[model samples]
Target: MELKGIHHVSALTANAADNYSFYTEVLGMRLVKKTVNQDDTSVYHLFYADEIGNPGTDLTFFEIPRAGTTYPGVSSISATSLRVKDDNALQYWKQRFIEYKVDHDDIITVGGRKIVSFRDPEGQRLKLVSDETNNGVKGGTPWKKGPVPVENAIIGLGPSHLTVNDPDPTIKVLTEVLSFKEIDRYPSLVQGQQDVRVFSTGEGGTGAEVHLETRPDLPRERPGRGSVHHVAFRVDNEEELQYWKERLQSARLPNSGLVERYYFKSLYFREPNGILFELATDGPGFTTDEDPEHLGESLALPPYFEQDRERIEARLKPLDI
Candidate 1:
């Protein structure tokens, strides 16, 4: 499998407008698409990415007001990490966060790298790491119209850190099933034999890592607001996608058969630790429906939900930002 990196990371949001404001104004990301949740047409499914909505640059959200508080424990995507150009860009964001009065932690060094931990308005955990080691952009674009200048802008999604109950089976999924290379391992945060293992694909840059931080003592996490819904990895095209589906089938791990999300083709499956993983195709991108310059300006619906547009438009509130 030619896994490029993170295709996108989708999490839940209680308020749509606040989510939009935080990602667009505070984080300075582009709202590439404003579409409804295909499974349920009433709620809005928003996408925030770099300039042209590149594959690895996407961080999306599902506005679900009725969802309860997020469960902070094992079997969850505990944090979504992003990478910037260099330390100067990292410092620029640190100062920018302070100026905007955003909630964030003091800088911390982990594994000889600087990272700034923060949370969105909805309490979703996020981290920004300097891309000093990895020179590649991982396929991204700078949003000139966004709040931050191009240099200081977030390059793309770095990694989706998975908090698993047991690391062994999850490791098997990555190393055996997904063909991820076990690059390194480190001591665990908790005082025990448990530890964090880093795996990667496609040359293993910043965004390409899949960190399995085993915290066996914690309780199992349930789906709700502020929790990651799913983490998607990118594949080149249809053939690679089919190969992965066959791998999953041969492994006897259950999967969602070829789902069309309008912008991309997706396959959903849960690993041994119960974290949902998606294999998404890279082609037939966001430009299929709307023009590049005018994405996310108005509502866009899939063909099946076109007739329900009137009702869908009525239920979802307009984004103030």
Candidate 2:
């Protein structure tokens, strides 16, 4: 049971093009892979991350047009954070937000990191925190154009914040199953009047804020457009993955049968608190399709979808890639 921390975060959106621009242009994430959602032939499953599309680096999206309106509540505060170089970069992003006309707010501390909160066009909450401690950039994928330089660009996803109706169950999963140690607790000054508990790996220093915030007064959320569909945690390989699967079953937590995505194998389930979670493998990743040099250009499909590629391609409307 060493469940590597969060793998990637996936969000549902009404428009792929807008979501793509917001992630790559506004938030400065590289679009690593572009493919249609397997279940929904017409919608795109866009993966944005550092250069090589590392797990934990990605913030993916599924474009669903007819998906309904949703509100931020206990189960759905999809605050995906990015780690920048230092306080200087934090200040730079604050100014950059003003220059780009993106709304932003002042400092908030989580797990000792100073974070500035902002929103995408779809109102998904995102933050940028300054971390000067670690410089490990193995396979780092950065946004091509932004005010922040590639070195200072968001190295990867910092955390995926889940606001739960009842934090106990989810908290148990993080601490017991996922090996995330609770680092701190704080009162949120934001609109939700929430209580935030942060969990992290390492000694809990540096850019650590894989947080869980709770709002006892808020209603629970359901899946739809502009919602975080799930948050994934990484495992080293199939051995660690099966260990987690058995642990989840022994704990009586419901889990998806291991599903192969070709690039990696994934298992999905919901914590008792209602937020969806997935355990994803870390190797044999995105380079399976095109060259590592050109990952997101053109359509890339799993072996299962190769023959049906034409039908899937036909259903999806072209976006300027």
Candidate 3:
């Protein structure tokens, strides 16, 4: 029943190429894995993160051409934060954001740590906070290439904060089934004093925060063209997956049917808060597509796409990865 922090976060983007450019060239995240959505082979499922593409470091995207508009409401989520080495790293990120011509908010203090916020090409909110100050940067991602040096690049996920209308079910799921403890709570500056509660895994050292802000004056989120698709948490293997399956059933929570995703098996569910949550197994990971040493060098696909590799490669717009 011990959950190992967030596995990865997935967002929907209008263009895979644009998302690729920003995450790689601008933000300096490594292209850890590249493949098509297994369900819809034409669409791309891209993942970007720190070195080795560790679980929490991941921020994923799905590019579907026809998916319609974005609605910002109670159900929609906001900025997902990444952890950096320290205040100096935060300054490094600020200048990088400026150099790339990406819009960013001035540095703001949250929970006694400094964080800088910015948007990806598709307007998904993201932030980089000082890792040491947050006391969550026990890990590091080595940079393969970019303006930001390895030491300054993001360490990994700080927290995937959710803005939920009802915190009870989400809290229950986190504490009861997922084995997350109520670490602490505080007032947040990002959303004007939204109650912030943090939870960390006994195993991963990565943490997730839940922010509840009463925006009675504002509208709830409508998910469409550009918004989070789902957020996944890591489970080590089939044993862990089954543990969660029984746990969810016991709690009377609904689950998306289990799916074999090549690299991992996954279970999906929506929290009462309306955010899509997934539990994905840890491995037969990127190596499934290419050897570990040569991963992300070309258009990699799951075994199912191996037969169409030639056509799939021709269809995707060429990039200088």
Candidate 4:
């Protein structure tokens, strides 16, 4: 059973309203789901994605109001990328970042693709990669109603970046256990470090690759606001998700088995270096409970939480999006 590409990447934010504004207004992504964290109902769990919140398009955030700043190092999902149409789209975004006064770097090539690296107000590391030369795992459609024009809008997720002290353990899990094939390598942006290795799954394109960097000199990351919580890969359905759970168990890896995310099923496990990875299903998506036209317009809770909606809503701080 081969897994699909990325399903979603969840990060942390101290302020849901500000996060909402930045992702929707500045990044031009649609706020597809405004919901509470299932584990803790007091805070917000916001999802931003391309039009209709398709699988592989989601970039989610968990609100941790008092979270501290992230001290970047090894064993972290150091950077998460969003895909754009082409090289021209990168130029459009570069200019737009200047217009918005957003923190960004000039367009640069990474692993044979053009990309513009940037950060959110909370210092969450992000990159916009051009899909001009991509041939595998097609990206999602942009939100037409968002601020940016369709041609220049952000599409879906690209290769996720992982930093580790030693790459062998992580590489072993990715290759032997997860079935990701090492496809390419590129010079590390950091001087004197080993070259970054590229790994791909499923269709093997921009959307399906993982960029692994080894940084033995750095310490473990202190996760807080702006740090990625976990990165999820796509599973086709519940059957496949169950298979993955069994596979994880058989491999003697500790995991959260068969998590009912309501919108989708999931199984979460951490690799050898402590980076959280989740295998998630593709169907029963954001549109499950809310109308596509009005997604994120109101607070959404799973069926189990419906009875407690009043109390849940009372505990949540109103997001002024």
- Candidate models: Cα lDDT each: 0.85, 0.75, 0.73, 0.94
Q: How many clashing residue pairs appear in each of the predictions shown? A: 1, 4, 7, 0
State the local distance difference test value for candidate 2: 0.75
lDDT of 2 by residue, 110-204 (tens): 55568898977767778887776543322245655544577668877776788876788888888887678886777776675766887875334
Error of 2 at 69 (Å): 2.5
lDDT of model 3, residue 44: 81
List, residue by residue over 1-321, the lDDT tens digit for candidate 1. Answer: 468778899999998998899899889999989999898888989999988788898999999988898879988999998878777887888898899887898777665567888888778999998787784336478888888999888879987789977788998998889988988777765677565788889867787888889776789987788889989999988788889999999999999988888788899999988889999998788888889998888888877788888889999988754
Best of the candidates, lDDT: 4
Residue 27, candidate 1: how far off, in angstroms? 0.4
Superposition TM-score, candidate 1 onto the true structure: 0.96
Candidate 3 vs candidate 4: which has greater TM-score? 4
> TM-score: which candidate is best?
4
Positional deviation of residue 163's Cα in model 2 after best superposition, in angstroms: 1.2
List model 3 lDDT by residue over 122-238, tens digit each: 678788877664543265455656556887887677677677666677778777777778766778564654567776665533345434443444566877666877778878897
Q: Lowest-lDDT window of 10 residues in candidate 1?
A: 130-139
